[model samples]
Target: MLTPTDVLKDKVAVIYGGAGSLGAGVARAYTDAGARVFLAGRTEDTLRKASAEVGAEYDVVDALDEAAVEAHAGAVVERAGRIDISFNLVPRGDLQGIPLTEMSVDDYTRPVVQGLSCQFITARAAARRMVAQGGGVILSLDSGSRHGTPMLGGTGAADGAMDALIRQLAQELGPSGVRALGIWTAGVADTLTPEKLAGAGAPAMDEAALQGVLAHLDSLRMTKRSPRIADIAALATFLASDAASSITGTWINATAGMFPS
Candidate 1:
């Protein structure tokens, strides 16, 4: 049985998009849980920073590029002897706040294509190595927006694709000793800044506006608070551990009860 300490001791974890805020948080949790984590992303500077903060190794690999992701998985296995945990936190270029009627076709399809492509590439690369090694965990994160979130262009389709992929992968890989699962979380309080919102094609909100939006989200949840980065990271660390060996083929809802299980 694994304890609170050393839950992931001597394990090798590869975190795609490890430079992002959520990625960094999960990387830190994995490191604290005693995994030798490798951070992979397209930006060297940010990856370096995140790796340094978490005492992890950094690799510049684009998750969307099949060749790069495959090579990275091979490199990690070459260096670590085995790949135990694979987590994909790569962002889909999703444009929100636009109704489907007014949204361009490109905007509607971008995330659906990019999200599924990257998830497939990274998950497959990790699964091959994991199957040969006996067993491992593949983790994915999605907004849980697929249930019917209006005004978020392509987000539902993209998230639904991811959910389906995780479920199907779990079924296919389970016999091979690979466990595929996902977490559904959204509106992380710390990740929602005006600049980031603007980048997602949402209107930049002022402080008051942001607070109001957050409050509305909180009110919608069973818990009257948003899930923090730390909350998601902690859940992710546990899910990656052997303690969660029997949990697969489904997404754990970390959406503060925004949706029923």
Candidate 2:
């Protein structure tokens, strides 16, 4: 039997937004699982740092640009021979805390547009290559906003779009041996901070308020503990490897039992 580290042996993985906290953790986990990781993001400095930490290759590629994503995918194929796993962790610009009735149309649609467009571009690029290469996994993530959390702005609509797209991709690509799937998580403990939350368009809050928010998130989970980056990394690693060949076409609930499937 293959050990944990050998599950992804000889696989070549491409991670869009690989410099972010979640992406970096997943890249490290993929490397540890014996896959060759290529980190792609818009920031060269962070990409360089993350890639160095995992001993993976790095490149600057805007996940939202179709040409850029296609070119990047082509280059990865040229260098790595094939892409066995393609994961998109791009940040969708989601504004929160404003009631849908009080928000402008633009504000309500930003995440839905940006998130779906980027995911489509990257997933299409990877899917075309994977179809030719026999088989691969195309992965993505979203905040579990589909549960209709109030005041979450466009997050729920955006996540719903992504959920539909992944299911559609699975149905269309499965015959070609390409699997499409996603993970649903929100308010990861380590990634949540005053600055990061504000940057993502959340209402600004002091440290105490942030702590209360974290506690609330923990209370919602069945485990009574919010998930950390490692939890997401482990799940991503398992999903990307051949060990999960039977799992695809849906979002693996990584919300720590925050909601039922």
Candidate 3:
């Protein structure tokens, strides 16, 4: 059995979109757990920064580009020998705040298309190498918006597609000793801000209004507190470890009870 200190000792992990806040958090946690992590994203500057902070290697690879993703995976395999875990944290470009009646077909399908494409590309790249090496894990992060929540635009559709794809991947890859899973959490406290809210198609708000939004989000959870970056990172560390060998196929609810299992 692995200890808490080195649960991922000697493991090699590749994180897509590793420059983002959540990806960087997970990379730091993985490094702390003794994994050799590689950060992949489109931005070299941010990837370099995140990689330096976590003592990881950085690759400028666009997750949505199939050729780039394949090349990146091959490079990682060449350097690290094998990939033990692959995590996708790519943004889906979702435009929320508009009702279904007002949304254009493009607005409703952009996230679903982008989300599935990037995830499928990255996951497939990792899986091919993993299958040859015996076994590994593929992970993703989503909002779990399949509950038909209103005003979310394409988020629900994107979530449903990713969820179904993960389950199907698990079933097909299980015999090859691979595991595919995801985490469902939204309105993360650390990633929330008025600017981000506005960027996601929500109305601009002042500090007071943003706080009210945060409080409303917190109230929706059974814990009455939003999940932080650290919380999600810790969970990712465990899911990537052998300690979670029995877990696969479905998503783990990390929303702090915002939705029932």
The residue-by-residue lDDT of candidate 1 on 1-261, one tens digit each, is 766668999999999989989999999999999999999999999999999998899999989889888888998988999999999989899898888999999999999999999999999999999999889999999889887788989998999999999999999999998999999987688877778888888676899887887788899899888899899999998999888999999999998888767
Winner on lDDT (2 vs 3): 3
**Candidate 1 lDDT (Cα, whole model)?**
0.91
Q: How does each model score on TM-score?
A: 0.97, 0.97, 0.97
Q: Candidate 2 residues 91-202, lDDT tens each?
A: 8888888888899999889999999999999999999999999899999998877868888899999999999999999999999999999998876798888888897666
Residue 152 C-alpha lDDT in model 2? 87
Give the clashing residue pairs of candidate 2, or none.
Answer: none
Q: Estimate candidate 2's alpha-carbon lDDT, on a 0 to 1 scale.
A: 0.91
Query: Tens digit of lDDT per residue, candidate 3, span 129-243?
Result: 9999999999998988877788999998899999998999999999999999999997678888888788889898999999999999999999999999999999999999999
Candidate 3: regions farther than 4 A off: none
Better of 1 and 3 by lDDT: 3
Query: What clash pairs does model 1 have?
Result: none
At residue 40, give the lDDT of candidate 1. 93
